[model samples]
Target: MSNSLRLVIGEGLEHLEAHRAGAFAGDPEAIHQARVALRRLRSALKLFRRHLNPSARDGFNDALRALGRTLGAARDWDVFVLETVPAVMAVIPDQAEALGALVAPAQHERELGHVAVRALLEAPQTDAMLQDLGSWSGDRVAFSPRKAARQLIADEAGPLLDRLAKSVSKRATGLEEQDDEERHGLRKALKSLRYGIEMLESLHGRGNTKPYRQALSVLQEDLGRLNDAIAAVELVHRLPDQPGRLVIEAWANERRQEALIELPAAWHQFKAIPAFW
Candidate 1:
């Protein structure tokens, strides 16, 4: 468990460094990846809370989540400009100028988001949080015994994966026509499950996890695309009235419907796939 925890926390910090480099370079994917690693780290912490100080576990996870949100806002805009906008333009070329206008605001938002992330990273609280996490991962802080650490996979990790899967399957029973909130919940659950598996990847050989992770990624991407459409519509709603807003909404709606149509099959496939943990 200590090794697993160390692996997750170490990689998470490494990702934050990558995010810092990317932020300086203004690379969108770096910000996105860092946020993702933060999320995975938090999920890993939650799964192993029994081995950690209860107070420390929640506090560290909360701090990382707040950081993730900062990067997430920037990533959201990146998705809008790089993905949603392009998709919209392809379907509604006449709205190019309007879409360009949308990009301007999104770019501004992403810039502000980067500034926010940088500020958070520079804050004393953020430094303390990372330092504490480093202590745990680096063996300066002890959370569990050597025996416990080694047996975490066979004793604890597998069961957590099974329980999370069951929960998601129950939540997704009527997913296709489900409201926005339900699909959103499904996405969150799936990510938790994915991260849980990822944290244990070192325990399981890649031969088992590789295909499972790839398959899991397909559903994650589909859910992400669906959520992007939903979010794009919401973002457009917040903008000032313009000729392009309606067209963008129309395209988003079409995309949203298409995603909804595809999601159930993906969900079914996900359910059919065996757990690798």
Candidate 2:
């Protein structure tokens, strides 16, 4: 196996171990880090599929995706309750009455999220999935030719780009509906796209994919800010009435609106860029 593949597999297993040990300790940052490792492993496999069995890689990818989604929900809820709510309160001090209305519902949502995360962790499939990954890592794999690698990358890049386009479209739809959860899902999609782009850059030079990279970066930043704002709003809604809540809420609202306006333009720029694939 190539050094990149070996590194990714090792890193993935390490994180999986931590996850299995409940290292997150119900902490959002820990959960996010574990999810990120899973993502990196998935992206690595996608980028280097030419060096492995397609069927085996696909199965591993599917498992990682499932785990990532579960962890993502838990992390999002954690951020909303612990980080975002307070920030929102700071921005909208005058809206204390409205913010108070959100506390019970946010707490209820967080409880549900906690249950889901625990269930996912305890699922039997998780063990089997990790074993499969272990098996793959232990096996010695041969590398494909450069030509084959290029072709595989090109093939995968098309589908990846399509996935990103669909995600952006979904986010647009969610924004129109004012569905916070759906918008957060879109942020997750943007993250996947950004990570994919980073992996691709490892194969293709930065110069070759500069426009795509730049556009993707802009989208990632915009979506990241929006996610933070959304989390802030949820957080402030959960906090007891406080003097600083109004200021935070106002700031979050302003940031959210700015991010919303910038997202489409960044997305359009991303769409216009020629795919290196």
Highest TM-score scorer: 1
Error of 2 at 226 (Å): 3.6
lDDT of 1 by residue, 137-187 (tens): 657255654455556555776777787788678778788668999989989
The TM-score between candidate 2 and the true structure equals 0.63
Worst 10 residues of 1 by lDDT: 140-149
Model 2 residue 98 CA deviation in Å: 3.2
Q: TM-scores, in order shown? A: 0.89, 0.63
Writing each residue's lDDT as its tens digit, candidate 2 over 1-277 gives 3444555577667866776546235656667777787887886675566567777788888989988888877777777667665555565556656655665666777677767767877788887787778667556543444554434454555665566657666665635455667767777676666666665555554546677778878877887898788667666655676644565577778988998888778767776887665
Report the error of model 2 at residue 118, Å. Answer: 2.2
| Candidate 1 regions with alpha-carbon error over 4 angstroms | 138-150
What residue pairs are clashing in model 1? Answer: 1-149
